[model samples]
Target: MNKTVSLDEIPYSPDSCERFEALRELPGAAFLDSSYPHSSSGRYDIMCAQPVACPEQPALAATETAWQQYFDELRRFHKDYYGTVQPASQDIPFCGGLLGALGYDGGNSLNQVSGAPPATRNSGGHLAAYNWAVVQDHLLQRAVMVAQPSMREADRNDVLSRLRSQRRVKHTEFQLGGKFESNFTESEYRSAFESVQSYIHAGDCYQVNLAQRFNAPFTGDPWTAYRQLRRTASAPFSAYLSFENNDVMMSLSPERFLSLHGNHVQTVPIKGTRPRYRDSGADRLAVEELKRSSKDRAENLMIVDLLRNDLGRSCIPGSIHVDALFEVQSFPTVHHLVSTISGELSPDRSAYELLRDSFPGGSITGAPKRRAMEIIAELEPDSREIYCGSVMYISADGRMDSNIAIRSLLCTDNDIRCWGGGGIVADSQWRQEYQETFDKVGKFLSVLEEMS
Candidate 1:
């Protein structure tokens, strides 16, 4: 196992111990926990990244060469386990880099974490970021996952209580910000129209997902906040993931990254969106409007087609099809038009290869995947990191599943940031697109403000 410890950086403490214990109870498991905290937010989250292949058996030898060999073996394991492989895509060259460099290599490890340098809060906003495709050269192909499936909620709660009791000072926390109804004042709508006109004229993109960040303070554990959001409004295939130090806590989302079972692979890409009214009747009307909106439907269809093409690359001959199209689904925040695409995998293929073919989902990137990605690189500020990318996991039996990393947070040593966006299309209104982003991030922002 690649155990990364930084004795000079931050010593392991009771909090880490509690999390480790909580996850250790699971069968055939491995753990990847982080301690990065969000500055000002004062919240840290711990993530149980993945489960090891064999928990009881003595681990494979640990040498530099051995590590490389282990990864090669894991690749085969994925192939044998999933029976399909992601196709090689020039669009996602960076997938390998992210996995190998930041994820598996010592890059993300604590031993390599400290004393090299310190970053100014938000100071690196202007720093040049690389595209995921380009970063592929830096990543390790296979990640080390620790699975501890036997840990119970009660056990975790006890550990939390113990840690809380041991704290010498009252801890700070985060809270929810309140909801907002933009109502699009008349002049504001006009401005939005103008923005769309400008975008159309520029030909920068046919569509853009617009959004706003909500600033708020949260008053307790970010993980608890995530649980509440999830429990209060659950979505099928929804996920709750935390990174070490609560730097990354996500209860996401309205999108699916990928799902594979018994040679059947599918992806549901959500695009078009509209707000839900608080009034029952109005909400119904709003949802109906969203379902029929030409702009929204068109956007959803485009993504569906994109997904079909992605699945086609890995599926058996004549096995690809669109299972669902333009279906409106309701989430806690908004209504979305989503489409599902599925295909029977080639018997010779494997899940790792399947993902290789379509890593960093197409929905977020847009049509002519590679071209769209290049556009995104020019437009977006930083590398998407986990945002827009998907969090993937494989079951012991080799069922592959992943979640699109939207409605998510990425934290380092001193800051936490979350990203949200909407798909833009030819007929899209810029202001409306912007509002969609706000609608998406509204809840998280409110909660953050509340905490503050």
Candidate 2:
């Protein structure tokens, strides 16, 4: 059986970021910090440490069968509490991260998309590892200690006390040791852009998101870099994960891949983009221009339709509908056209099943999702790993929330890597699309430059 022990409330403070920084020192730590806490419906700031459970290997394939097997194993390991601690209408009871490359196995016919053989680097797995931990919910000022039924009360209290006592530390210094390199050169990217356009003209796919990876040798505190990233590009679904063996993930993602509350599921796909202007007037104009762009509207609508179809597979018939469309949301570095699609999940479906149907969000993959993945694989030089993967939380009672792993960074023993890209339609400009990728990642790149 599972256990939930409520402890003394941590003093609520606006500056939870400091507390989050302090919590990162713990093993297998993860934090989800909200950019707009007051407006958020669920727990805004959550910090979890010392995972009592985790998967032995990452879920690497995006195939439904693979995911089913992976989930089966995960459920097996946590059998004692598999169906306990039901969602309390407002509680999120688990913590985990979903790697982006899982899309490769999610029933897409991309087996022929060629690239260099998959890198042997252990960039964490493509699947999420759910762990029972001591979780701090800053919004409710509550600390929930989830442990095995056998864990003693005194131990739970000790863990809660340590979490309450954590405080922000002085930022550490990091150095970017060498010049960063892109996996694809400008000409090469342009060539890929043309290839995607040709596919569009051939009626193969309407839109395809093409991306390039950037990497540099580095040696520094990843936590410090994550702190800088938070300050530079505070996003609605920001996350930080520190694993054993020096592997780290820092995500400041603004897109919501999926969320499940009760049997209701929602996805917010982001399609359009415009760089934020420092000048107030210019910024207003940019937002207006994006709002009026027909091409962007079309781009967003196509994905909205795509997600509607994906959700329909698992949702009650006639229950799937668009909640919002072409809404412009501004982030620290860019403006985006975001749309919300929601549906009531079929009664028999579990959260994992919902994810299986919508493994990769449509906004990132483009219209006719399968064809886009094939093109992405054929053109991109390496496996995306976690770049476009998801960082998510799945509650024990089957609640879940996930973010498309955009505006993210990965750290290994010697190198730091990040990726940025946009969806390509026939009307998309190669140069502008190239610039958009940089614009999307500009602040993150700036942070790296400052550290270098």
Candidate 3:
């Protein structure tokens, strides 16, 4: 009923992006990238498209039961395709199931089961039950193409041929019309910061994340912009998703919201950040500063505790534990203090329930999630859309992984938008916090402008 073929004919390239370039033209093309030279946090690249079944919820089409309806559809798809499926071989992490984005609004709604006002804007989402995926396991130095159900031999041959073909597809080049413009000006951001401080002082919440959006006019292929961005902003959880509406979502997120393999679960939250510097000495100093900052450590601890409670809902009692805390991770443009928490999922729990119980990742939402979200909605000028959402894969074999979509860009209707933000706490300074947002996305904004 399933089909899988080794792609041994295709040469292994460290640059996974090159392998995905040709596949980008395929219908429903979606790439879950580990990038080239891969990050310490990632070891595989899963590229898939041509889903057998895919359910999508538009952002503007959200309702109280909208997220529930979408999940029901996803469950139906899984039951039909993956109810009796098997995982791919060669140590591949995914054998194909649900591959898509969950909108921020929708993810945020899950934790608001009681006494919360309806979301100002509902989250739109997508989950496709893909029968096949081209999986690259860098650690094993192997490549595999696995398809389930009826992938005819002819179809297999055609896909393999296209993959081995040279990368020469040309589309309109992506170029920004100008430098990006922010939704929050300096004064506006300052005012929001003061408001957050007021809430903290009033004991309304421990911390809240405030984000500002940036937009630039652009022309040409969205994939081109993603290609350019992956070189610099790429992280362990990076992804590029192409929609039929010609909408493109590019996520260079470094935060892992959740991962499930068998009954084991893990989540890594990133909280503290320091910008990268051109000078090696200055960069080292920044790393040391982040490692030593009491404010940063306290903020990280709050999110860790928040997630412990969230995961507890679906995890076996007393099985949850913090695997690591306050670990420093360096990326091309920033350094982060990341903490990992793991648990053994209750046998009665499904990955879907786990996701539902813990969506939109607490690191991005801050402590006391519901109240923090209320504060965010009151302050942020626009709906977050999919910016703080997730790009995930739930494999047929029951393995799952997702990224807290940050340092992300959404391109549509001749407009490109990206977001950057940080957690605000009692001790956080407004001006420095404002600049921190820029530090997170400075590379992405600058690179697009340079191309123009």
Could you say which candidate leads in TM-score? 3
Model 1 CA deviation exceeding 4 Å by range: 1-21, 24-74, 77-172, 175-220, 231-233, 242-246
| Candidate 3: residue 143 lDDT (0-100) | 74
- Where's the lowest-lDDT run of ten residues in candidate 3? 113-122
Candidate 1 backbone overlaps, count:
73
* Candidate 2 local Cα displacement, residue 221, angstroms: 0.1
Question: Comparing 1 and 2 by lDDT, which wins?
Answer: 2
Please give the lDDT score for candidate 3. 0.83
How far in Å is the alpha carbon of 15 misplaced in model 3? 1.7
lDDT of 2 by residue, 267-381 (tens): 9999999999999999999999999999899999999999999999889999998999999998778999999999999987767677766767777778788778888877888
Error of 3 at 305 (Å): 0.4
Which stretches of candidate 2 lie above 4 Å from their native place? 1-8, 36-43, 54-64, 75-80, 88-155, 166-170
Query: How does model 1 fare in lDDT?
Result: 0.47
Top candidate on lDDT is 3
Ranking by TM-score: 3, 2, 1
User: Model 1: which ten-residue window has the lowest total lDDT?
Assistant: 127-136
